[model samples]
Target: MNKLPYIFSLVVLLSTSFGPSSAQAQERRGWSPQAKGAVIGAGSGAVLGAVINKRNRAVGGVVGGVAGGAVGYGVGKHIDNKQKERARIAAANRAAAARNAEYRRSLARRNARQTVAPTRLQPAAMPGNSLVAGSAAMAYDAQGNPVPYASNAAYLPNDAYGDASHPYSTSEYRRKSW
Candidate 1:
């Protein structure tokens, strides 16, 4: 009947319209990570491109997306390499600085030893409050017996003019005459 033909025509129209959509879906199914990323980028680029241009919008978008992704990847890799190189240079500089500091310390020690005078060694018998070593029958006790003394003994100056009543009245400088 007439209804049968109309239904058949409607079926054909629906298939024609849906067939392409189904094919497009199949093409997108199970895409790899990079492919999916590229497709997404392309789609976004196409949208932007279309906004910017009335003609060749799809082609412009695809080109722009690919270029952007590639450039982004390259720039990222370049920055990573530069950062690694900078770190290596910084480490080398630190090591050199440490070595230089150590060298300076050693040189300073050597210079100090050379500039300062060494301690003098003398005979022990001359232990008369002096930095003399190896004294022979010197320093006598109350019984007049010689005794060995230390090499570096503290110097004790006898205050011949100081007394218990004038403990702080001692002066080593002579008074000037006017």
Candidate 2:
């Protein structure tokens, strides 16, 4: 009969201690390692203490539970901190990798632009021909095909050199004989 009351008290204590904590843990998401450790430590400590101290089980259980819970919490907290540090390092590496990839892409684009051949608007030189002051120069399109000079309109007045009455005529020199 005395043992029955002791058993009942133990059961009630365990239920009250762990039930609400477990429920709260579940509601928040899941049991953190610390919470899981604490629950396991407390239960195991109580069992061990009850077995060890036959005369005063309750006092032994309380002392054991506190000591076990403290150790469990420390270990759990250490593990959690290590995991968080690892996650932080992983995130930093990922960010650096992304930045490096972006920099490479931008570098490739700049190199591609620089390496492409530029389009020529005018010929560097004409084979077997010399440039004349009043003549339209040959030009080239992007495809290397011959095209009219962009300044051809400026040379159009030179065509009137053939007519003596033109303002740029050399008739006065012809009449001077020198």
Give the worst 10-residue stretch by lDDT in candidate 1.
169-178
Report, for every candidate in turn, its global Cα lDDT versus the true structure.
0.59, 0.69
Error of 2 at 114 (Å): 1.5
Q: Give the TM-score of candidate 2.
A: 0.51
lDDT of 2 by residue, 1-178 (tens): 7689779987998998677564554546777888877877777887788778889988888877887787778778888899899999999999999999999999999998865545565434443333345444565655677654424322333445557776657432222111
* TM-score per model over all chains: 0.32, 0.51
lDDT of 1 by residue, 1-178 (tens): 8479659967997998576664664546564445545555555665676677667665676577776566555555666678789999999999999999999999999998865433333334354655544543345454545433433334233343455454343742222222
lDDT of 2 at 134: 44
Report model 1's TM-score to 2 decimal places: 0.32
How many pairs of residues collide in each model?
Answer: 4, 0
